[model samples]
Target: MSGQNCWGYGGDNGPLNWHKQFPFAQGDRQSPIDIVSAQAVHDADLTPISISYSACTSLSICNSGHSVMVEFEDCGDKTVVSGGPLENPYKLKQFHFHWGQRGRQGSEHTVDGKSYPGELHLVHWNSTKYNTFGEAAVSHDGLAVVAVFLETGDKHANLHRLTDALYMVKFKETKAQFKDFDPQCLLPKCRDYWTYPGSLTTPPLHESVTWIVFKEPILVSEKQMDKFRMLLFSGEEDSEKQPMVDNFRPPQPLKGRTVLASFKL
Candidate 1:
C-alpha cells in the first residue's frame, strides 16, 4: 500500500482505485482541478511571481515507474521561487512531466475544459519554514508547484535536451546523471497564472501544494512528445512492458476552494 509499484494509471490500480490504498486520494483540496476561467477571481493584491533557477544545480534524471523527473541540488537558497500567493520563498527540488499517448489529452489540469498535450511540474519546497523537503511535504503550504501546459506546435529548442536523454532511463527505477540543465528555459514567456490550494497529483496525495498554473502553454512538436511516450512504466526485469503514456491524473473536484487569477479575466 505504500510502495511505488502499488499504484499506477491503469484500470486495475488507476486514480479510481487509488482511494482504496491511500485515503487522502478522496480528500478535499486535491490537485489538477479543471480551471474554469470565468470562475477564477482576479486578485489585484496578488503580486507577480519571482523565480531564480539560473543558479540551480541539476543533479540527475530518473524514471520512477510513473514519470521522468529531473532532480536538483537544493542545499541552499540558490534556486528558489517566491511571491504570487506564497508567503515565503521555496527551494527548487525537482521537475517532471505528465503526458498522454496523443497530442490533445495529456494535461492534468485543463483550462475551460480544454486539455493540452502535456504538463510540466516544477516542484519546490518551503525551505524557509521547513528544514527538509520531506518535512515540508505533509504540512499545509509546504509545497509550491508551477504547472505549465504544453501544446503541439513548433519544436521547442530547450526540451530536446531532456528528451534526448530519455533513452538512458527508459525503464522504471532507472536513473542517469543529468547536469546543468536550467528549468527556466522550459517556461512560457507569459507570467499570468491562476493560484489555488491543492494536493499532490500522485500517491500519498498530500494536501500541501500551492498550485500556480500558467495561462499560456509552451509549444513542442508532436515528434518531441513522442519521445516521452517511448518511456516504459515497467522495470527492465518485469515480464510485461507498459508504455508510460497517459500518466496524468484526471482533474479532481474543486469542492468550495477558490481559484485566484493573477490577471484580469
Candidate 2:
C-alpha cells in the first residue's frame, strides 16, 4: 500500500506483495514520494464542479485500515472519464479515503512542505460509453475522480456523513445516510493539478484512470482523523498497525509518463 504496510486479509496487502494478488498491481517502480510537495503549482485553472448527493442504496461503508468509504450504486450514465465533458458523463459511484490518524507519516503524496493526515477519493465511471469498469479497465479513458487531501483541524462539522457511519461497517454490505453529499465542495480553490496517465490506486489496479491530483489539500481536524482509526481488519492479525493504513496503493511508476502541471508546458 501507499503507507508503511500492506492491507489485505492479512499483511499481504503490502506494496511488494500486491503484484501477487493482482498481476497488474504497480508495485514494481514509482518515485516513492515522501509526499513533501505541497507548494502552489505554477499555473492551474481548476475546473468548475457541482456534485449533488442523494441517498445511495448500495453504499458499502467499511474500515479496512485506511479511511471509511460510502459507495453508491453503479449507474451506467457516466461520462466523467470518457475523455469528454460532463454532459455525457459517467454516473458518480463510490467515494473512499486514504488516511492516517495523526501526523504526516501516512499520507499518499507528499506535498511541497507538508503532508496531511489523509486524502479523499470520489470514484466515478464512464458508463455512457463503457459498459462496465472491467471493460473500461483496458481503455485509456475509463474513470474520473476528484481527490481532496485532509489535514488535522478542529472537528469536521460538515463531514458527519462519513464519521457517523464509522462503527456500522463491521461486516460489509452495509448502507447509511450518506445524505446531501456533493462531490464538488471537496476541491481545492486552485484547479491547477498534475494530470497524468495512471491506474486505479486500489484493487484491479486498472491502468485506465485520468489522474487529477489537486495542487491543494482540504482540512481535516485531529478529531476527524481519529474517526478513521475505528477501522479494523475484522481480525487481530490483519496488520500490526490497525486503521493506520487500508486501501492505499503505492504510487505507480511515471513509466515514462509525462506529468502535465496546470502551468503552461
Candidate 3:
C-alpha cells in the first residue's frame, strides 16, 4: 500500500494473504489482537491517558485505498497525548476508521472475542525522540495508537461532520479539505484501556506501535454507519468499483504478550 503493491482488504490481497508480501504480518507483535479482559494484568503504575486536542486542526481527509483517514497538522505541538504507559508525549498525526459492510463484525480489535461494528485508530509519533514520522515509524519506541470501538445507537455530532465529507472522497486517491476538526469529540467517556506492544495492521506492518485500546466504545447511529460503507476501495477510473467495507484485519495471536490495564477491574 505504501508503494504500488496494491494491497487491499479482499481476496488475494486480504489480511490472510498479506504475509506473502509483508512478512511482518505474521510476526509475534502483530496488532488487533483479541483483548481478553479476564486474562489482562492490571498495572497500578499505568497512568490515565490525557489527550489534549484543544488546538488541533484537521488538514484533509483521503481515501487511502485501505481506509478513509483524516490528517491533522502536527505542528508546534498543537495536539498530543500523554500518560498511560507513555514515557513522553506523542504528537497526533492522523486518525482513521475500519468497519464492516453491514454487520457487527468490522472492528480489527476485539474484547473477550467480541468484535465491534467499527473501530477508530488515532495514530501518533514520539516527537521527543524521533526526528521525523518516517524515521520513528520503524523504531521500537516510535509510535503510539489509541483505538476506540464503535457501536450503533445514537448519532455522533462530531462524526457527522466527517460523514458529510465522505462523498467528496468516495473513490481511492481522492481527498478533500477538512479544517478545524477536533478529535477529542470522538473519544469514549472512559479513559480506561488495555495497553500492549504490537505492529501496524497495514502493509509494511511495522512492529513499532504501543496500542491503547479503550475499554468502552463510542456510539453511532445505524444511519451514520451506513455512510462509511458507501466509500469505494478502487479508484474512480477503475472499471470495477469495490465498496470499502469490512476493512479491518482479524485478531492475531497474543503470543504470550502481557496486556496491561490502565485501571483495576
Candidate 4:
C-alpha cells in the first residue's frame, strides 16, 4: 500500500469511476456538496443518532489524499446510531481523518457556514436491510456517517496511537491491535451536528450517504498535526509525498435538500 498502489485517484477507485465500479453508488444526488438548499424543506421522519465503540483486530493509518487516516479493519462490535422508521439503520464500518495546513481549514461540512482545521469521519453502512454498500446506494437511508471536527488546542493527546500507524499503511497486509481505544472520546460532548445527504469524499464519490457532521470540534496538538504529514503515498519518492490536505469534496449544491441538526440539548 506504500507504492502508489492505492487506486482512487487515477485508477479504478477514482471518484469519477465509482458509479460504474459500485452498482448501488449510482444516482445524480451524490454528496460532498454544491446541492443548493431548498426552503429548509423537512425530514420530519429523522431519527436520533449516536455512536458506540468496540474492539479491533487490526488497523492501518494511510495518507489517503484526503487526510492521514488510521483505518480500522476486522473491527469488533459495531453499534447502530439511528432509531425507528429509518429504512436502513446504519452500522459502524471504519473511521478516518481529514486535515489541512496547521492554520488552514480542511473540514467538509460547515456549520451556519463555518469550517474547521480538520474532520474525523466514522463510516457506517446499512446491512441489507442491503447486503453491501453497493446495494445500499438506492435505499434513501442507505449509509450514515458521524463526523467530528478537530481544532488545534492544548487538549490531552489521545489520537497518538492512531497516527503512530502511519508508517504501517505503507506496508499493507500488516496488522496491529489497537487496544482499549474509544471513538466516543474523540467526539465532543456537544452533539450538535449538521445533517444532510452526502457522498464519499474519496474517489468513486458514491452519493448514497446520510451525513451527521458535528458542530463542536475536538482538540489536537501540533505534534498530532505533523504526524499526519508523515504519511507516504504508496511509492518511494518525494512527489508521492503530497501531503494529505483537502481530501474533502467541495460542498455540493444543496439541490433542494434540507440540512437538519440535533443541537438543542
Candidate 5:
C-alpha cells in the first residue's frame, strides 16, 4: 500500500479505516502520540541538534490533497540536520503543515494532553545510507522528522510568505513555484526537544521516523491561521467542494516506548 491515496480525514476513509488499506497504521510504533512530559526521561547524552538550511534550494509548494508542502532540492548536503539523536546528517527533503479550523485543536503530538493550533513537520532523509527519500522512508533509521507546534499569538511574518502563496495551490494536486524560501525562518527561538522512535502520522504510516518534537512553539495570529483554512481538499473539477480543515491525525498510544527529553524539566 505504498503511495496509496485513497485515505482521507473524513467519515469512511478517515484514520479509523486507514488500517484496512495500510496495515502499518496499527503498528507498534505509530506516531502523533500524546507526550506526557512528566514521563519523558532526560538524556544528558542527547546533544543539541545542528541545522544548516541557509543554503537550502527550495523548489516548489504543493497541496497534496492532505496538506500544504514545500519541496526542496536534496541532491546534495547543502541543507541538513545532524547531531542530537541522529548518527548521520539527514538531508532536508521537504516541509509541510497540519492545521485545524479553530485555534486550539490541530497539532498531532500533544504535551500533557494539551493540543496546539497547528504543527509543522520538517522531513529529512538519511542520504548517507539511502540513495533516495523513498528508499529511506521505510528503513529503521533512515528518516528524521523535526516537529514544531504552532501557537496563536502574534502574527508570524515569515509564515505569511507561505500563507500568501497558499492561494495558488488551493486545490488538490496543485503546485506553484516557491524557490529560495528558507525554512529556517519558521523555527522557534528555542531548540530544546523530545526524541523518540515513531512512524509517519500519515499513510503508509512507515515505522521509520526518529521523532524530534520541540519544546517551544512559534507564534502565529488567528488571521494568519485562517489563510491555511482557505485551502480546499477537492480538486478543481470535483462537484463537491470540501474545505480543508482538521487535517491532523489524533495522538496514538505511547505503548511503553520511552520519550527522551533534551532538557530537564
Candidate 6:
C-alpha cells in the first residue's frame, strides 16, 4: 500500500507511509503544519482577504475517492479570493473537506498542536497566468487554498445544504448536480488568518500551494459530522466497502518556513 499511486488514510497506506510513493511527502515545504501562534510573525502590511463569492456558481458535488468535493464554474472569475499575499485574483475551483473517524480529532492543520474535528479546503487557481487548474496545480505559484477549521457545537444551518446531498454521493466516484450555493455561510465570523507556503496534503503532493488558514473555527453539530463519516471509500459496485473517515493528513514539519499572521496573536 505504501508504494501504490493511490493512497488512503489507514493502516499501511497512512500519512506515515506516504513518502514511499510521493517523494514530496518528505520534501521541505509540506502542508498541514502545526501553526505556533507565539512563533508566527505578525505583518501589519498584510492585506485583508477580499472574497467576492456572492455570485459564485456551484456546478456539482462529487465523492473523489479521497474526500467529497464541491466543484464550481471557474470559466470566469465570478468567484475569487484576492489580496493578502496573493499577486493576482485566484479563481475558485473546488471546495472539499478532511475529517477523522470521530468528531474530536480530524483537521489536517493544527494550531499550537491542537486539532479540530474537521477542516475545509477551498481550492483556487491562478487563472490570471494559467490556462487551467491542471496546469496551475503543478506550478510553483499557481494555487491558493483557503482552509477553515470545523468545531463540534451548534448546528450550522448552512451546512445542511451540502450534508443533505451527502447521501446522493455516499459512495466513491459518485456525483450529483449542486447549484445556487454560496460558501460565505460556511466561513467564520472573523476574517483573520495565517498564511504560509506549503504543498498539497494528498498524493502527488505538489509544493505549489499558498495556504491561508483562518484563525476562528466554524460550528457544526456532531450529527452533521456523522453524515460525512457515512460516506464510503469504495464505489457502490465494489464488493468491499470502507467508510470515509480520518481522511485528513497529519501536520508535517515546518522546516524553517515563517508563518505570517494578518492579525495579532
Cα lDDT tens digits for candidate 1, 1-265: 1114557887867899989888988898998899999999999999999999989989999998899999988659879999999999999999999999997899999998999999999999999999888889999989999999999999999999999999999999999999999999999999999999999998898899999999999999998999999999999999999999999899999999999999997
lDDT of 4 by residue, 1-265 (tens): 1112234444666545655765534545555553223323335455555555544323444444444444455333355566522355576656777666554676666554656677788877787477765676545667777888788886446677676656655422333445455666687877655677666665445566777766678888867776665553344444544444445544555656666645432
How do the residues 1-265 of candidate 6 rate in per-residue lDDT, one tens digit apiece? 0112377877887789989877899989998899999999999999999988987889999988889999888558878999999999999888999988987799999999999999999988899999978889888889999999999999999999899999999998899999988987899989999999998999888898999999999999999999999999998999999999988888889999999999996
The clash count for each model shown is 0, 25, 0, 24, 0, 0
What lDDT tens digits, residue by residue, belong to model 2 across residues 55-116?
A: 33444554434446665665334313322223345556667777654567455655553566
Which sections of candidate 5 miss by over 4 Å?
1-4
**Which lDDT tens digits does candidate 5 get at residues 1-265?**
1223556899877998888888988889999899999999999999999999988999999988989899998658879999999999999989999899898899999999999999999999999999988989999998999999999999999988999999999999899999989999988899999999999888989999999999999999998899999999999999999999999999988888999999999
Off by over 4 Å in 4: 1-28, 34-47, 55-67, 70-78, 84-88, 137-139, 170-180, 237-240
TM-score of every candidate relative to the true structure: 0.97, 0.73, 0.97, 0.74, 0.97, 0.96
Give the clash count for model 4.
24
Candidate 5 whole-model C-alpha lDDT, 0 to 1 = 0.91
Q: In model 1, state the lDDT of residue 40.
A: 98
| Candidate 1 vs candidate 4, TM-score winner | 1
- Regions of model 1 farther than 4 Å from truth: 1-5
How far residue 259's Cα lies from its native spot in candidate 1, in Å, is 0.4
Q: Which scores greater on lDDT, model 4 or model 5?
A: 5
Candidate 6 regions exceeding 4 Å error are: 1-5
Which 10 residues in a row give candidate 4 its minimum summed lDDT?
Answer: 1-10
Judged by TM-score relative to the true structure, which candidate is superior, 1 or 2? 1
Question: Model 3, 94: alpha-carbon shift in Å?
Answer: 0.4
Kindly give the stretch of ten consecutive residues in candidate 3 with the minimal lDDT sum. 1-10
**Top model number, lDDT:** 1
Point out the higher-scoring one by lDDT: 2 or 5: 5
